[model samples]
Target: MSTGFDREQGEFARGARAAVVYPDLGGSSRDADARLEETAGLALAIGIQVEDRLAFRLRQPKPGTLIGSGQVETLAEAVRDQELQLVVFDASLSAVQQRNLEGALGCKVIDRTGLILEIFGERARTAEGRLQVELAHLDYQAGRLVRSWTHLERQRGGFGFLGGPGETQIEADRRLIRDRMARLRKDLEQVSRTRSLHRERRQRAPWPVIALVGYTNAGKSTLFNRLTGSDVMAENLLFATLDPTLRQIALPGIDKAILSDTVGFVSELPTQLVAAFKATLEEVITADLLIHVRDVSHPDSEAQRDDVEAVLADIGVAETTPRIEAWNKIDLLDEERRAALSAETAQRDGVMAVSAATGQGIEALRTMMAQRLTAGHRRFVVRLDPSDGAGAAWLHQHGEVLDHWVEDDAAFYEIRMAAQDHDRFLARQDR
Candidate 1:
């Protein structure tokens, strides 16, 4: 038997042989380093095992290679030596740059957008999600109409006799993709309508909805699963949970309210992705409360927070929507930093620090959410006739009755409730 696998492996090797490259045009070296690491993480998520990385401090991007001629030659040699099957660029690349890089390196080249699209294509679970990913992919490939259609030379239809169609294979493929996109759009619209109807029904229920949103892999899903006792997919990978999962969280005081975990936002999330996944993100827009979770231990946590907020604003969730900020992943922080963060943000009403993984400060978060839910309630002390079962039933259904004392002639009650429900309570008592 052979001792170990050789570096020169088959094209269909189980592990990907990949490399990362970035053009250092501007920004701090620390930022560039972080981006390279993040890109490597993204590549790994897309089933690519990054074998090596190359960074060039180019003052400006070359139109063809993005890393200049000299750097391209060096990178090509490295790719040959390492036997890389694919190359990933940290920054977004134009169609020309992508084609040139692939030709020069003699391997498949992917930019940040393409890599992200590939991950989405692989991770999408629901029919709507799959359709959305396909739409994005078609839109992306449409722009790069280069060599992908070179295999349609001898294709024919029917019983394998001869060529049949007037249109080329490329044209026919484009038409088929367009038709599928049209059908997907119609289906997505129907899904949207159904979701709206479900939302309307939930409005009539006695629950306030709280949505958790943050950057990818920022522990939003973990917090969601912890709070709701759900077994939703929570992994260390990006976009682990694409479909929004809503679960009923029983807060201590307010026994039943919906807590929805929405898809994470990212910096420069493809515009096509936003357009296609609007159905999934509707949870964020319709939420009564938005919980913004941030990874406090991250070096760029504040910037990530701003990115999430920007996406929220774009989706119309930033206009007067009540939002609470959760400084998550506190378990990763040291004592000094934790104390510093706590002291800095302590006075803010909507800000709280917690660890989703270790279940730290979760009870306080639940209490805070309950307090927000009950903020508008007015304490009501009402005296009703003891035999009036109808009034008691109305109160029980419409509002939370704190306590009541049974008397011979009437019932003494203390209630904390919504103003609208309080009005209804008075009307039923009068009746």
Candidate 2:
């Protein structure tokens, strides 16, 4: 028996033999083979045993199955021959189409959105992460309740003899889901408020914020660990890190910076998740500098870069936000290819070639970051009264005091700081 839920495990059981069906709609820029490989990687990430894979040219989508009847038969035969327990579609499937496919193939069926949700549900660990995942899951499920409980549609007569309207089980279930979603939204608002306050506090501090973003399994966590010297779960799997992590690290010529490792982006990230995790992604939006880490060795590196940028745009990241690209995993390339890439990176203004695993080019990357952070700073000379010890100390603590001296009852000082910091200091003095 194929079981979607495992009672003993307290979670969905993976390891079921599965088959992947990639529907190649025309005009897509992504290479079909690379998309297939990525879908397989997602399957492997969840411990699913992929037994067969096939790609079909989808000239037009079938409303019932999203594929032609002949292709559906072919997939059914493949499932039977491979003895697959699950069938995964690389494209989105409507709830009715999913149900029809499961019935036709005699196995469990899920779409790209469902698979991503399952992976996120399994990987989220923190309270906030879990909450976001649950909210997204509920939102996705609310639309599928009709297919989930088909038997509940058979309505009975009204409770009273007056023949009043009767509520079907599906309607009641949907109402319950809607109510729960409202409560979850309320809770999430509180969480967002708390996070906003924390971000405000960090803004008041002296350190700059640098966020790391990239496609899934793009070695972001690896680069983050190399930079921050913290042991986060840097594994070679898709969506390995779901919760956002922040650590303080010192940059060359800079006292400290807050480096954030965020959840990696994938092509076609679920809309439900995008809405639910807005609070978590606020860090990326508010970052002073963004480090876009790319796995340069991947065959579809360019496509992955585009996908990451698309997600960033969806999250409302301004086009003017300062960003630097780190071409990581140089160690994975051949010497010849590595040298070629090195040359290419040199030609780019804000790009660096680095291998986080080998500590190669990390120093150069750090220097670049420090330079960008301090690029627009200005130097100012101000006179202060010697008795005003607090103002003098504040300037020393907040900005780089280039030189200081006291002449009679007056104190002469020079300081270098970012333009914004200087304005903030002046505002503070006025108060």
Per-candidate TM-scores read 0.85, 0.89
**Pairs of residues clashing in candidate 2:** none
Q: Which candidate number maximizes lDDT?
A: 2
Residue-by-residue lDDT tens digits, candidate 1, 363-419: 999888877777788888888888878778667655668999987777988888888
State residue 144's C-alpha deviation in candidate 1, in Å. 1.8
lDDT of 2 at 47: 75
Clashes of 2: 0
In candidate 1, what residue range of length 10 has the lowest lDDT sum? 154-163
Q: Give the Cα-based TM-score of candidate 2 against the true structure.
A: 0.89
Instruction: Give lDDT: candidate 2, residue 415.
Output: 87
Mark the 10 consecutive residues where model 2 has the least summed lDDT: 156-165
